[model samples]
Target: MSRSCSFSLCAHDWSAYQLAEQLGRGVAELWPSADRGRYAVLNRLAELGYVATRQELTGKRARTIYSITPAGREALAAWLGTPPRPPSVEFEGMVRVLLADQGSLDDLRATLQQTRESALANRDMFARYAAYISATGGTFPERRHLFALANTFMIGHYDHILPWTEWAEQQIADWPDTVTPASTNEAQVRDMLAPGREVWEHDHPDGA
Candidate 1:
């Protein structure tokens, strides 16, 4: 909830259903049961006086709408002022590739293919989302700048994944089997490692 406020103030008025849908797409997909989980969280926030809830009629049905309290805004402001931890990478595809020698090469190839497909799908979805936000300014026109920056990063991530998986798949194509070190392409490995080595050596002049 605090993180949502950091992105947009209008998020203060979202219903739990809306929060679940928006968070599932724009942020991390809620696990287990998003709707139930968000409803429970919203109730807790209300109990803590961080959010206030009111019943509003939508046609024939009445839904509970939550709005952040002054306390919520203060909490969100404090969260934004704090420095965030470093980004973490948790790519299952990369993990499989790293340990591929201990498993079947076919499994690695399938993982790469699945990764590429997932990236493609994400790219297409985000492309449409960007277009929507660009054309319509989305729900929060005031925060379009933040959304633009985030969408750009997501697009770049998918762009990198697509080509990288393609390159990895090509490398796997030439391998005879998984385990043999003799099947490794030493020159290709060195070429791939060159940029990192150069940067590390440049930073540590004494080779420390």
Candidate 2:
């Protein structure tokens, strides 16, 4: 995905620089490599039939914002209904977890401390964005909705990670002597059969 395309996808307006800034912010938040993040956005836009380019508007070099065609809006609506694919997690604490044997308890603690700080900072930023959305009425109507959704997602994300981090810290302090793998056979079996059950048994029992 090109940066241009990705920027266009999320933006209601088509300012290239603004798109670039948003791309940078997304890269930081999502932790993808710069090239990959830009390309992903471009690819998605292409798939949706939206072109990203700069053109002269009113004799000024301005981003020629392409309006979403009816088909494009329909595609976006369909895409929105599906859960976003999980971004690759590049969290530093996970690396520390893998190399915990190489480091002392203090090192682990520090790593976790830094991770928590980063999470809190991110939470604050999202909160601020949500506030901005509430304050500004003239920005994209859809953007206000997207901001709310992003805030909700961020809250859930923090809620999930904060607890896990706390649990991990406690576990490290207590220092388990043995690790046991839980049984996942039943869950795995259910997961494997879940699609067929939903599709064949529920949605199309008579083979439509």
Candidate 3:
């Protein structure tokens, strides 16, 4: 997904300070190449007429609050309307796991552990957002509905990854010293390993 979409969503219901903090945690660290800084991203959004800045004078000093403009919403909608590009994540941890056949089991464990740790961290992050939404009694029903969906996706993602990583760690820990390939695709190999779990493994006469 484009950075613009994430930024637009952040401004949808949050103040500038909140957005900056979230951007720092989510985008700045996740995609540092695309990000300059929190203020720079906000300013770019303003320059493009996709975000509006309002000056608010607090008791101490002035602050800037940003909101996504009509154009911004339209842009975001257009992005959502089209099919997204293929996933091209740059996570080196996964890259190591992909080429694990060339490396030692210890290296595989270390790389998968990194991914597992990352998944747990992200799980905690979204759990806080989920708690916030819950505490508010589902405030902003429409927007919060989508935010809740995103939170659910992230939570589910990590939930799956956590167990998968654990399973992978165990499998690697007990990997055969002279194992050879039985299948090419992971799903096929998984089915070869799993006795009767997946329905897709069945040859249905009705093709149902």
Best by TM-score: 1
**How far in Å is the alpha carbon of 62 misplaced in model 1?**
2.8
Question: For model 1, how many clashes?
Answer: 0
Q: 82, model 1: CA deviation in Å?
A: 0.4
Each candidate structure's TM-score, on Cα atoms with residue i matched to residue i, is 0.85, 0.58, 0.65
TM-score of 2: 0.58
What lDDT does each candidate get? 0.74, 0.59, 0.67
Q: Could you tell me how far off, in angstroms, the CA of residue 92 lies in candidate 1 after the best superposition?
A: 1.8
For residues 1-208, write the lDDT of model 1, one tens digit per residue: 4455323323647766777667666565112233245546666667777787789999999997778788877877787789985766657778888888888889989999999998898888788889998899987777779878988888998899999998888876878777764446778778778989999999999999
Q: What is model 2's C-alpha RMSD? A: 9.0
Candidate 1's C-alpha runs over 4 A off are 5-12, 29-37, 182-184
lDDT of 3 at 95: 74
Best by lDDT: 1
Comparing 1 and 2 by lDDT, which wins?
1
Per-residue lDDT of model 3, residues 1-208, tens digit only: 2354355454464556767555554443345554555556667777888777787878989887777788887777787789976755567777787777887767788888889998899889888878887888443455678777777877887798899889877665546521344333456467547755455447554667
